[model samples]
Target: MPRSTFHRILSPLLLWRLRHINDRVYLILMSVLVGLAAGLAAVLLKTSVHGAQQLLYSWVPEEKRVFALFLYPIIGVALTVLFTRYFLGGTLSRGIGPVIYNIARQNSIVPRSKMYSQLVTSFLTVTFGGSAGLEAPISVTGSALGSNLARILRVSRRERRLLVGCGAAAGVAAIFNSPIAGVLFAVEVVLSELSAPFFIPLLISSATATVVSKGLYEGQPFVLITNSWPVQAIPFYVMLGLGTALLSVYMLRVYFRADDFFERWPGTFRKVVLGGLALGLLVFLFPPLYGEGYNIVQALLAGKPEQLTDSSIFSVYRDENVWILLLVATASMLLKVFATCITVGAGGNGGMFGSSLFTGALGGFVFARLINLSGLYPISEVHFIVLGMAGTLAGVVHAPLTAIFLIAEITGGYALFVPLMLVTSSSYLISRYFEPYSVYTRKLVQKGVIVHADRDRGLFAQLDPLSMVQTDFMPIHPESTLGDLVTVFRHSTRSIFPVVDAEQQLVGLVTVDTIRDALFDDEHYNTIRVADLMAPPPAIIEPGDSLLDTLGSMDQHGAWALPVVNKGKYVGFILKSAILAGYRRQLLKESE
Candidate 1:
């Protein structure tokens, strides 16, 4: 149906609902609906990717599969680029970063195109052997759904943002079948602030989405056969945590550097050709780097590390020595980030969420195998494999709680909860010390985009400093006498006046107190120029300055207002009172 027609049909029902349903009850209903839609979107993307992979590779012979792997990613990335260029207007934002940005800067309003753009592009990228994860794309799709749904319902900005979080949580829950982890992800990563009221909606949305996914899809992503985690492995877990933290930092730095290099490499065609070929060569050398690599994680969890080399040239060396397998695993883990960067930087649509897990599993497997070979102790490779995933996820995303519960819930047990807590916390603290922001937030922070997890900073970011610029203060000429200043002051409501030159550049400020003594003496009214009565302002503000920085300047100078100057010209003054009032209005809006 057309949008106008749809709105017309639902207008009466919406009015009835507003009269009969309270806000809390309406929010619950909206959460369930959004969850269901988000779940279906996730299920559709996963199924399409699986189906495409099967259709493309199911007919190929095992002996010649290596050749197919070399050709598929190039074709996939090319197709993705073509689709994005022709169909999506040559722009597609893939990952959780854009979604977080929308919430922070765009009033939680996601573009309608995002609801389907990510699904189609990510399907082509991942299904055709692109080394990226569908989780981020699906989450973006879900967030778009929630945001647009709130738009249709004509809800307040606060409620719309909540719905956005609901959709994101639902997507995560449906993808992993871990509702608790989904809720935590929304709190830790998406929502700027969390309160008691947010819990019920988040829980309801996540659980509902999980139900929809389970009803349509079967089986978990990875199955863990381990029953218990030994206490003696605590030392190994600690070491593993430290190792994953360092690895997380390495992955973030390498991915960003490679992405930047590709960005500066000039032509799009060159990037596609060179990046696709490079990615294909990497995947061809290490078969485990193909696609999301969840299958490798499953194989590792199943205690069959040999399978990683099944379709590779390293297959011949798989059984020669345990050290050979370790070498291949180490190489694969180190190079996975490059493959992911090429896939994305070359126009593939996907995220690093799965790459981190893939590298972590390999890192954990290598760590455990080396320990056993040392003849010092025997550790469960399975336990460390799982712990490695949690540790790296915690460090990479900077959300330790989400990592802990996600691993625990997906593994179908909290058997490793003790070790998970120890490892994830350690990794998070260490990673945070080295890299303050997560992979999703690092570039956004560097570009001065508002991606804060703190409530005050987030709220203040929503208040634009330029909008509060007060142009009501009368501009006075520097050559004006005290008689002219008295005439302007009588007609002006403000206590301060800006003295400007011929070019409208602010020279100084003249306040009521600055000329209090001059007002009583009219003998020198024509003698004393306005330049003699004015003094330099305490501080100057720019149009692009942040509210927090403006507040800091105001506090430091003990000034109630600061002149807003841009490009050597005076615009107006920004009063501290306006900022406080705007902040209070924002706070009240969010509370509602």
Candidate 2:
């Protein structure tokens, strides 16, 4: 049935049910439904990608797989571009970044098309080896599912936002089969605020999603069968923490630089040809850099680092010297970020979540191997490999708790909790000291969309400055005499009047104080033009300015009101009282 027809049939039933049910109880039921849907979406994406990969490569022999690696990424990216352009309406927003942006700036309302756009595009990108991850795309899809469902049910905006969080939590939970991690991810990464009331629904959603995922998908992403970590390895874990922290910073800088480079290219075809060839070359050189690189992580965890070089040109060199294996692992870890950037920047849909994990696994392997080779320590490579995943995840995303729990849950135990806390905390602190924003939020912070660290600035980001502009203030032409200004001021309740030219461009402001003395002098009122009495405003606000910027200008100029101009034309004045009122109203809305 058409969506409109379906909604028309379901709307009355839902409305009647809501009238008879407690809202909190109703929300729990909705959370369960959202979780099931999000989990199914996650499973669908994984199955489709895995199926496509097997179909593509199961037929190709091992010896000639290198040739497939060189050609598949190019084709995958090209197909993704075509699909996005023609099928997805010429644009597709990929990754958790856009989801967070929607929550912060778009009133938590995700586009309806996002329910399937990222899934299809990411499948095309990653299935044939675009060197990216599926988690972000699926999370975006899940968020969309929640948002659109709430819209269809005619829920309040606050309830819609909560469901969006539920959907995101479900997606992460389903993808990794880690419910606690999913809830934490929703709290720490997706949702702006956390309260006791949020936990029950989040838990319900995450647990439900995990159940759905486990029922259908049968394996964990990584398996660990290690004993408790040795006390003597504390120092080595500390060193690995520092190594992962540095690697996190390096990846962030390089990924953005690569994105910038790709953005400079003129057109989609140019970006695809250039980025595809470069990515294919990198994958050909290091087969471990192919796809999400989870297989490489598996090899590392299983103590088979040699398997990393199995399909590469360096396969022969793998048996010759241990240093060659170490070199390949190190190089692949460093280059994984570039491959990810190229894939996404060249029109493929993916995110840095998996790449960060891939880099961390390799870094841990290389770190442990070096120490063992030096005859310094015989630490458990598996422990470091797992811990490295947590370390980089914490550092790159700045979510230490999520990193700690995700690793613990995915590994089937919390055996490494002590070291998990140590490594994740250290890596997160070090990475934050160098770069204030995470990989997902750096550009957002630069563009002033949201300030992740400050609740006040974040709230300000959500309140649009344009919404508070006081257009009721009368505007007077610059050529108008003081008598004309007096006429506008007498009829208007505002204490300030904008002086505009014939073209409607704002020239200056005429405040009551500026013309106070001349008001009583009838002779001077006729002789003194409005332009002569008017003074330039201390500051001007743009239509796109955030409330934070607007308030900052108000504070800086000590002005009770400021004029808003767009392309030199006067839009209106924004008063301090009006902003405060809007803030109070926003707070009330959020509380409700």
Best by lDDT: 1
Model 1, 1-592: lDDT tens digits are 8978988998998899989999889999999999999999999988888888888887789889888889899999999999999999999887898888888878999999998999999999999999999889988888999999999887889889999999999999999999999999998888855788888998999999999999999989987765787778788999999999999999888977886787788878998899899999998998899999999999898878999888888888775678879988999999999999999999898988888889988999999999998977899888888889999989988889999999999986587889999989999999899888888887677655777547888889877777899999999999999999999999999999999999999999999987999997879989999999999998888877889989999999999999999987999999999999999999998777
Write down the TM-score of every candidate.
Answer: 0.93, 0.95
Candidate 2 versus truth, CA RMSD in Å, comes to 2.1
lDDT of 2 by residue, 241-292 (tens): 9999999999888887877777676798989998899999999999888899
Task: Give me the overall lDDT of model 1.
Answer: 0.90
Give the Cα-based TM-score of candidate 1 against the true structure.
Answer: 0.93
RMSD of each: 2.4, 2.1
What is the lDDT of every predicted structure here? 0.90, 0.88
Clashing pairs in 1: none
Off by over 4 Å in 1: 259-266, 447-454, 476-492, 500-505, 518-533
Report the number of clashing residue pairs per model.
Answer: 0, 0
